[model samples]
Target: MSEAVPLPAGTTLGKSFEYGIDINLGTSAVPEWQPFRRISGFQPTFTPTTQDAQTYDDLGADNSDVTGWSFAIAFNVQVNRNTATGLYLPEIEALLARTRPSAKGEAAVVEVRWYHKPEIGTPNPADAGQGRATVAITRQNTGPNGEIEVLSVTLSGKGPYTEIANPFDGWDSTVAVIGTVGPEGAGDGDLVTITGTGFLGTTGVSIDGASLAATDYTVVSGATIIAALPAGDAGNVPVIVTNAAGASAPHTFTRGA
Candidate 1:
């Protein structure tokens, strides 16, 4: 009899539904990302433009060189309208408004961002992409009797897509809360343990506007950080923690005697 091998821990298959798409309703300088709701069958395609590379030297092998890339995403959403509010879903409204004949050139183009949803209880960052795309909406056939109305929306890439940090990564709600720092009064080179919540991905620690060296701080967990105090004025200085999301509110830390 053959011995059975055990599967590795944390092994799980990726689900097709574990992806999200967002449309930017605001400008590049001030982006407001609104997720597409009630969507299904989200599909993204990256097609490469290739050029014939096979020459007289090659006998019968077919070969080509990739020249460029193109991206597009398609998804279907159930038509939803709030009767009381007399409003359609933001994403649906945006799509319908942009596809109008009056909407031309830049007016028809919208910024888009998409990401792979991160797994629960894991600190893994989301893989994301950003670019501009034009929306196309098509009405789907109504099913026999009970099927709800649906619209298929396709986003055609207007230009090149670029990879970026997931803007919707749950870090915004994980702002570090400074509960307390041991040794209320400490000076330069003093090791201080910071007790707080949401300190997992701390990027920088600053005291009185002076940032600590990267090697001076260690994020032990989501609720603890050990850092060497940087030299600062002798007073109640503000200590702030910054992460991928943003900067946390400054917590007063007594410095010196």
Candidate 2:
């Protein structure tokens, strides 16, 4: 969290839709969450479910019921021009491309978040609210002469869209990512350094289900650990970390052949 700057009196700053936003989307069973990049515009709407309660004979008993709600968000996605792909188009395509006929591939809910300040700026109180919904590509229009190319994406949700929650509040899930493992394809008797977070007081670590002895690993800090690869067959194996908090999602480590 960064220090908050005071806003001047009577000053109104328009929200900048250029950056500081993320969109997470995946299936109902497994969510391959990813943040959106190169976004240009965003608009969200909410709709409520209603039901009639008035009887035909009772005009004075006129009534209606509001039972549930839903929501939608519309936004513009930008495409970069270059010999190679830019920062975002490829990732966006990966998600949208999942809408296939087979059961193995299909579109699912998307989680969207917006940060009013620059992404690198200190975190503010308004930085954590998010919405989730199924998305649809509404239109594609090349911007006016001087503007960048863009795609209009609209996401909608039905049957009880949930209320936005502060993702950082009471967030207990341990999200550990293997940023790098030196000697990436090392063999037995080789030592490796794994760098990541939420590693304080690590209880155990394993490679391919073979537990490494205490002497084999050292908890360098809350963000790092050093361990030796157990002697085993050459192949790819999962690396698991366990602590008082819980086990982290398995990360793949390839062993030398």
Candidate 3:
């Protein structure tokens, strides 16, 4: 292959051939069996501020040349189109007075995916925290009746966050309000159906504590607590389910008659 310039001396060597070949290429990086993660920062927020939440940061480095076990994080995300469609939990709220001298502790939940179509669009991933972060995230909505709302929520970019914002507070998940205990061995009032769990504005019902002016009962999802068998006597009866963010700790039922 003598330098690429002049080559026509004798014009007769003998044989020159490059047999059996096919070519097609286009690759820079991100393919070695693909399996890597290490995200230590990310903070995106927008809950009705005319949609605009940007400024990102990331961290992660451990290649050992090729593979010895690697963790990685690289970030730059902020999608704004008034961002809000539900499920944006980024609570790996780092608590690192962390002085990892060399190595002996690791909190891993490295997963970052951000996709929002607004041009060159298509990047959707909202989940950060597997080792523990207040698990902060919520921007949910789904059409009609009371019209659910939550649009734009992402917070977990490592802290001692002296306080840009810290303290994840959200209550609307009381899960447990079921009813079906009537006319069998009956003890108190016997008119059953007091399913309760954060029973939204549920004015009254009391079994073993005895305070029932009586209303029939039907509350389904402040975490359910349905009652209607107050003539008690079968064993295991401690029923307590109230709301306004209060009573919920006596959910045991076994008094059928």
Clashes of each: 0, 0, 30
Which pairs of residues clash in candidate 2, taking residues 3 or more apart in a chain or in different chains? none
Give the candidates in order of lDDT, highest first: 1, 2, 3
Please list the residue runs of candidate 2 whose C-alpha ends up more than 4 Å from where it truly belongs after superposition. Answer: 1-21, 25-33, 55-62, 85-90, 98-132, 142-147, 164-257
- Please write out the lDDT profile of model 2 over residues 75-145, one tens digit for every residue: 77776544564444554665465344431412465555543433332233333335555666744765566
Of the candidates shown, which would achieve the greatest lDDT relative to the real structure? Answer: 1
Report lDDT (CA) for all predictions: 0.77, 0.61, 0.33
- Model 3, total clashes: 30
Report RMSD (Å) for each prediction in the order shown: 8.0, 12.3, 25.4
1-257: candidate 3 lDDT, tens digit per residue: 77877768744333222011000011111111111113212233422212232234323432222222222222222222223844322221221111223323333212222222111211111221111112233334456765534333332433221111110112342423534334335555565554433454333455666654423444433334344554555665666655434565665555654
Q: What lDDT score goes with residue 22 in model 3?
A: 9
Candidate 2 vs 3: which has more lDDT = 2
State residue 38's C-alpha deviation in candidate 2, in Å.
2.4
The number of residue pairs in model 2 that clash at the backbone is 0
TM-score of each: 0.66, 0.46, 0.20
Model 1, residue pairs in steric clash: none
C-alpha-based local distance difference test score of model 1: 0.77
State the displacement of the C-alpha of residue 113, model 2, in Å, after optimal TM-score superposition: 4.6
